[model samples]
Target: MQEKAVVYINSDDSGRGFLGAGGSQALETFVDEIAQNVIDPQANVSVFDRAKAHELVDASSAKAKKEILERKGSRLEALGSGSDFSSFLQHLGIPTLNVGYGGEDGGGEYHSIYDSYDDYVRFKDPGFKYGVTLAQTTGHAVLRMADADLLPFDFRSLYKTLDKYAKEVSELAEKMRENTEMDNQLIKSNDYAIAADPTKHEQLPVAKAEVPKLDFSALKTALDSLKKSADKLALSWTAASATDADKDKLNKLLFHAEQQLLSAEGLPRRPWYRHTIYAPGFYTGYGVKTLPGIREAIEQRNFTEAQQQIGVVAGSIMQLATYLAKPL
Candidate 1:
């Protein structure tokens, strides 16, 4: 967390990258390597590793350079940033760039009891330059997203993310089924009289009753159908440019269409959040539980519940695409 630490290269912040051994060291190495090799090399020697506050702040260049720096840090944090933005950037195919400023927030009540007007003025962002950096960084992101025609959504990234999650859920269900069989065996081996308890049952907590084999056929069908629907809508939007009125209406409608994917009810229990695309775990506050309905079902050992949620989510996806398919 260097003062005025700037990144040298453009990065895609996945937010789950720091999950293994040596993650912090790796982040330091990544930033140090990129700064030394890329950014510092390109800039005037005076700006090369100044190790102090930037005396003259250039908002425009800082904005561009900040993106590069944010990307690099994002790359390292992707190993594990431990925030709500993780799944959207890492798993949901969003080309996310985190750009908040001030290293002081990294420690000492910055995010806890210590972070206050007094502490901020006394220790962190004393000059308010970092706050300026934050403003510039946010403006840059907003401008980029607003001006871009493609909405910055990359379905390929989302597809891969979903595939991995699906595999994890499938494996968990299998493990539960395997454990159930093991329990049945241990029970049969017990001596007949003592094994059957009358008042105080000593029977092993039954492994979640064998989970039935799920037919992912329905899910695959739904995904394929949605893809076709999305493709059609994309084509329509592109063709609508011929009519100014239609184009304007299409743009506005398409812009808000994604918002429809969310459910105000949120997950089964947690209600504070509303986005259907992502959510925090009910138990793991800051941690994301992607496809919470299915993931939690498996984690809770509720196989039938998991299957039901799968259908629910699959339906949601298709419905979103169908909504997108409408002509403005």
Candidate 2:
């Protein structure tokens, strides 16, 4: 094992206890807190830190790159070199910390000459101030993670994501209905806007078009029920952490909670992916689909199907809520 370096864990973990048990109030609190307090980019932006590292060898000579490389006793570059900490941290699910300093050096040196030490010292860590900053940030992370009483995962973020997806699916259903209604009226009226105002008028499309009204009452009721369940679970879990009865209830609900969110038939087009919280949209690759059943149903202009899907999603939500409401 290489020398261990320290790192900070700044993530919020309010949802761990509720992971399988369903939605917990703690998870909601986590999301709320994050939205309220944003992390500073200079201080917390890990992605930027990673990107800045490449400057360590930019526009410089091989001599400089090699010098820094040798001094640091680290490779200037490693192909297929899975960074030591990444593979295990990311793949094995072990938390990881990647530490490095660079960015002042604009010295670029591809596998060629022109790469020399002449440029690195003058450019890369000019005063090495940022290097110190990096160290401080790293130390902060290590201390936070090591000292925390619990894992740092945020449940509120998860809930926010879910809420946004639900609204999106509902909106899709509305839009599809409107378009279909417009198409029907277009054929019935035989009045193309072109014919009505052939002079290229820019007034705007006519209004008062009636689209199918989706019955979200079922969904609302389901959510309300689930919220109640979540509250119940929080009360029970908080009051009796050591009770087997509470744990048993939570464990039983865990299986039902997440499972209830999935449709045996899967999304309308993509049957391979399941799971309500995380799924690939049929049209959007690499993008997540939330409340997909209803969303996809609307996209396909299937009102009856869309309406049915709302019930399905809502039922899942309620199931999860009930699970969370359990004693544990």
Candidate 3:
């Protein structure tokens, strides 16, 4: 049997901008390095980051999102337990990335009667260039992970990414509040006359209760601590040198850092899954929920549960921050 390299990341477009692709910013860069080495600089590429990374969600600003895509890449999409990497990532809390390459191919050729190696070789990726690109990208990542003394798990990148989630959820709550108020105004003014269908008799929609003012102070505090610790570690990362033991210790710590994110009582009812930061949505199956506890609760309009989940997420973040603050 021919030896093959383990490909952890898939580098492709989902492709309007980078919507379906999922991975870390660091790993994205790692994969991009491989692609840059092989693929032409001028090669036509498509990306997807336009979507809010959800099924019910749509891109907020196409022009602004595309600007981000043109500059660096997509907003690092979260991992869903839909792939082979789920166990290593969502369950065990290991770092993961998804990368793939494609953009030349257009619509019509999907998973149907026409998806074959012959057609792929002739039409999609002529000369199997993408196949080479994929090989190089995955091989290099594996090689680096295997050979490096210090593991490439950058917690600062993690902090920044997570901070965005914190901000996003806060904003989501506020947005929901505003929407609810507007709808309730319409409901009150029209006496709940709005029905699904104007012609047939349909149940009238009720005025939604206001999205309560959620106290995210605990979460905010935890994130503040996490940022400081992450910043400190990043500085250590840049220091002149360190003993092999220290580097090894730091690597081990980084490796196990994900464990700190596991809520002892995982995700409301699904105790099997841990790792609080990322999880598949209760409703959106394969679509991931960042800050799942808080995000899902708010989405479901369970203000009480949302408040409790906020505490859970805060505790998890504090656990991670405390772990990161450890001496090298």
Candidate 4:
């Protein structure tokens, strides 16, 4: 029996290669590393490296090219809720992988009664070569997971991704402040009435409250502390003297680390979905809400709720950092 396991999933009905959702950074890195390393057999190059080279040639602008080239690997888009991995990752906090191949298929008959073998072979994966590719790619992932002495849970990438999300929410608040100020100014000046045609009677728009300044310093400080702790943990795990017991302890820590991101109270209205970092948007269905508690509060113009959520998220990060900082 395998000491650890890697589940390989292929959402045949799903369109395109690896439409990942939930803990996307971790899963994307996992899949991308495997895809990039496994030779395409026919193409004679790693799938990821080939894709990267093509992107460089097809890039339209110097800035775009630079950004593409600077990227360490293929960009893994954030997961929303359209696949089977949602339950395992978001609900159970399991480190799972969702894999598939697409981009060549037109998906003309997707989810329809007419979607059959003829449709698949005719439009999607004409030679069934991509099907083989998917198996080989995921096979490599399973082998790596099963055979490796230590699991590959890259906290550095996770920290980097989370840091990016933090900056985005902070900037979102700042941008809202500016927009609200401008709207208030226009309302005060009766700009709408002034701009209205003389023939038509246009009602003045109601004024909204001034956007309050949000304090994200706590969140920022917590993130910094977490990054430092992640770096230290990475070093300790990779150290030459790390024993089997030490590795086992580290693995357990890694498993529970993601669970710490969950809030006991959950989001403002949604208690079932507990992940503080990622959740499906309340209104957008499948759309992802990064830092949902804070992002949604700000989006709805609820500063009080936003402030409360900030503290909650910050506390979670601090707790995780403290756990990671514990001596091995």
Candidate 4 stretches with Cα past 4 Å from truth are 1-29, 40-43, 53-61, 104-108, 198-204, 240-246
| By lDDT: ranked, best first | 4, 3, 1, 2
Off by over 4 Å in 3: 1-21, 24-38, 41-75, 103-111, 191-202, 240-246
Could you list the CA RMSD of all candidates, in the order they appear? 12.4, 15.0, 5.7, 3.3
In order, candidate lDDTs are: 0.47, 0.46, 0.68, 0.72
Scanning candidate 2 in windows of ten residues, the lowest lDDT window is 13-22
TM-score of each: 0.55, 0.48, 0.79, 0.87
Worst 10 residues of 1 by lDDT: 14-23
Scored by lDDT, model 3 comes in at 0.68
Report the Cα lDDT for candidate 2: 0.46
Best by TM-score: 4
Residue 165, model 1: Cα distance from true site in angstroms? 3.4
lDDT per residue for candidate 2 within 1-328, as digits (tens), equals 1112222122211110110111222233322222223322344543322332343435288786566545421211111112343232222222233344433323456234754444334444345445444445445545544553332333233344456667777777667667768866875676565466657664544544355788988777766676566556555545554443424444344323444455566555655444444444567753535566777667766778888878777776776666565443
- Residues 132-164 of candidate 1 have per-residue lDDT tens digits of 434433444455445645333323233334445
Q: Tell me how candidate 1 scores on lDDT.
A: 0.47
Better of 2 and 4 by lDDT: 4
Off by over 4 Å in 1: 1-133, 145-160, 182-208, 232-246, 264-266, 270-274
